[model samples]
Target: MIFSSQHLLFSSLLLTGTIMSISSTSWFMAWMGLELNLMSFVPLITSKTNQYPSEAALKYFLVQALGSALIILSAPLMMDMDIFSPMLLMALLLKLGAAPFHSWFPSIMEGLNWPQCILLMTIQKIAPIFLISHLVTQTSIPEFVTFSSILSALVGSLGGLNQTSLRKILAFSSINHLSWMLIAMLLSDYSWLIYFFFYSIISASIVIFFNLQQYFFFSQLFSNPLTSFTKSFMSSFALLSLGGLPPFSGFIPKWIIIEAMAYNHMFLPLLVLIFSALITLYYYLRIAVLSLLLMTTKTKLLSPFPAQFFASYLTPSFLFFNMFGLLVPSFFLFF
Candidate 1:
């Protein structure tokens, strides 16, 4: 009972901070809201009594702290300048898990169990990205943001290539998604919102799907594979969908963003972006293929599900978001 209440309170505070960040006009107020969001989430990261929890909590806290400090220090400059602060904006990128400053993402993801990672990867991302988009008009963020977007996509795709840990692969995938998100950031304000909504759903769905499986490590994919064809096919679809292959909701945002990029005539940038997509697809396909080696004598067939903290939160919730994104694309045409 105590644990339940604590969880409620923490979540409430974090959410309150997120909304406040969105609504705030004062740079200071937005900064405070970010701090509030960060502090609230720290407890969640450390809530579990495990080594990974403690380490993840520390990494998350330190990265956030550094990012927050940069924003706060730059606050005074922007106040007098009328122009949006580039440093503060860059700091926001770090906080949002964009590249160059993205080293923390995979490590932190490595430390958390999947549920926490899911939340961190999805809903938790909403606040910072929201604040960043809000501040875009105050500065010449388009070019700088564009560069970061490409970097994030390149790094994410390359980083995941030979990864053997499930968490690390998802971590890299999250980074790749951030690259697309940064592009959305440059295109339109609504684009960011649309990207966030869909991205969160897709990420949460993928994480939930992964959480249901037996293996935790990436190399373990072939070690013990799913014997049930239903489970195997569903999991494969989820990964493929994550790759933004057609028919699934995952492809919806990619289609929109690519179209949006083309409309903007960002030809060279688009070329770079497509290449990164290919790199990401390569790694994702590798995992899917390995998981299929379930029947081979070289690897063990899977066993029963182990009780995990994130498993419950992932289900139904994931199913809802996964399907929701598929339908939400209709609204974009009018925009």
Candidate 2:
């Protein structure tokens, strides 16, 4: 009971910090909010009594602290020259865990439990990315932003192919998505927010499913005791949606972005983005295919009814969101 209460308190503080940072009028207030969020989250990173959490918390602190310091230092320079813009941008990029600065991300994720991972991937990103969106408006978005974003997408696509650890795969996937979010930030305010929101929801649904099953590895996804055709189908469907396949909700954001890029005649970047999406799709399909193969047993089993029920309920939640933009195109139209 005490543990539960601690979680509730810290989680509330986490949300409060995120809201404060995004809504802040000044960089100092945003930094303060981010610090509040970082301090609150470090404690929660260790729900299990383990060394991994301690190590992860330490690494998280160092990176966030450095980023915070850079942001602070950049403020004083805001008056004299635009040189500090790159420093400020780099700091936020580090916080976002984009490639080249992303080394800390997968390692920290490896040490965390699913709930902590969810917060790390979803909520933790809100402030820094929103801050980036704001900063770019003050200075011309750097050419390096586009170059690094491309590198991030390619690195994320290629890095995850050999990873068996689900956390690491998701980490790489997050990096890839960060590339899209960065590009979207260049395009429009609504684009990045839409991408981030959909990314957060889709990621949470998938991670929560894994959390319920206590899966930590790709192989374990196929090793579920309650394996069924429906479960396998939904799992694969969710992954495909995540891979941004057409007709699914995940495809909506990608579709919009691609169209926008084409309109701007960004053909080369568009090609690279498409290539990365295809590579990512290969792995998502690999997981789904492997899981489906395990469901071929002729003998019917019903021992894990609770797991089955959870999967059934969760799958539709994912499907609804995946199909949301398709059913209501106006949602994307407005954005």
Candidate 3:
């Protein structure tokens, strides 16, 4: 229900590409669809007027281009082509900003506003996951996925340790999430898809709200009135979900994945993941502390735009997906 023509176009293209990438057996066709999705997003990123938008656009383009090149370079290799598949997996990991290759992610998110970052963090994850699923069985990339994800977890936790930028912290969190996603991708393909959908839903809502309030996002809106206490409360709840605490949508998929991995005897990686999650929790709490440091002052705020009937309807729909992630694990398959 997004209204702008350009917004609709990119969304359509993303949908089309996602479907095409997942359904097709031929890797080439899937890659082409990914290309289509990437080209489609350039306009969306550049359509905004802010300086951060331009920087985000450039960073996104360069990173995508590099990953695209890697995939294309490996096109000639056979399915079981030892390191070739690893190379391709690495490309997807890089594209997704998974560990070791994750430096670009924070910079990119830092430049974009909240709404745009929400789009990047959510919808953009689908394509690479699709590609990873397709290549997983045919290659020896599971080890890589496990290792990379561990790195991602470590980076996600440690990278944002002192970051003051709100979006950058989220970006690192996104990188950390990728590790879990890639690990999940090793088990059930459906797991990855469902995890993505629900996480995206909750995240988009929270980011949009953050942007609307213009409260300490991307080094701006520093004059927030939401006291540190309230921020800590919301941030804690958000981080708990992010940390995959039970009862929150974020934890269910992670719980399932950890079970799946343990069932397969991936003890070391699972332990690594758990440790990294602890690390991630630290930074998230750090942010919470910052958020909690709000002034004990209140001021009258301006009347913001009234939620259109459509937005009112849409908001709950999006939010429900987040809740759905927590509540009904099998809900997506019904759709």
User: Which prediction has the highest lDDT against the true structure?
Assistant: 2
lDDT of 2 by residue, 1-335 (tens): 43598888998999999999999998889989999999899988864568998899999999999988998999778779987888888888988898789999999999998988999999999999888888766655546678778988998899899999999999999998888888887788888888888899988988887887788998788777765666566667778878898888888899889988888887887888889989988998899888877775665444243354564666777767766656786667777
> Which one wins by lDDT: 1 or 2?
2
lDDT tens string, model 3, 1-335? 24788789887987788778767778788778778878887777774557777878988998899998888887657554556887788788787788888888888888776777877898787778778877778646776777888888888878877887778778887887888888888889877776786577667756865765575453443355433433334445665666666677787878888889899888888898888777777766555555544422343124333345245554455445445545575666799
Which 10-residue window of candidate 2 scores lowest in summed lDDT?
Answer: 300-309
Whole-model lDDT, model 3: 0.72
Count of steric clashes across candidates, in order: 1, 1, 4
If both were scored by TM-score, which would come out higher, candidate 1 or candidate 3?
1
| Colliding pairs, model 2 | 249-322
The residue-by-residue lDDT of candidate 1 on 160-229, one tens digit each, is: 9888888898889889988888888778877767766776767666776667664578655555533443
Query: Local distance difference test, per candidate?
Result: 0.77, 0.84, 0.72
State the local distance difference test value for candidate 2.
0.84
Judging by TM-score against the true structure, name the best candidate: 2
C-alpha TM-score for every candidate: 0.86, 0.91, 0.82
Q: Which ten-residue region of model 3 has the weakest summed lDDT? A: 295-304
TM-score of 3: 0.82
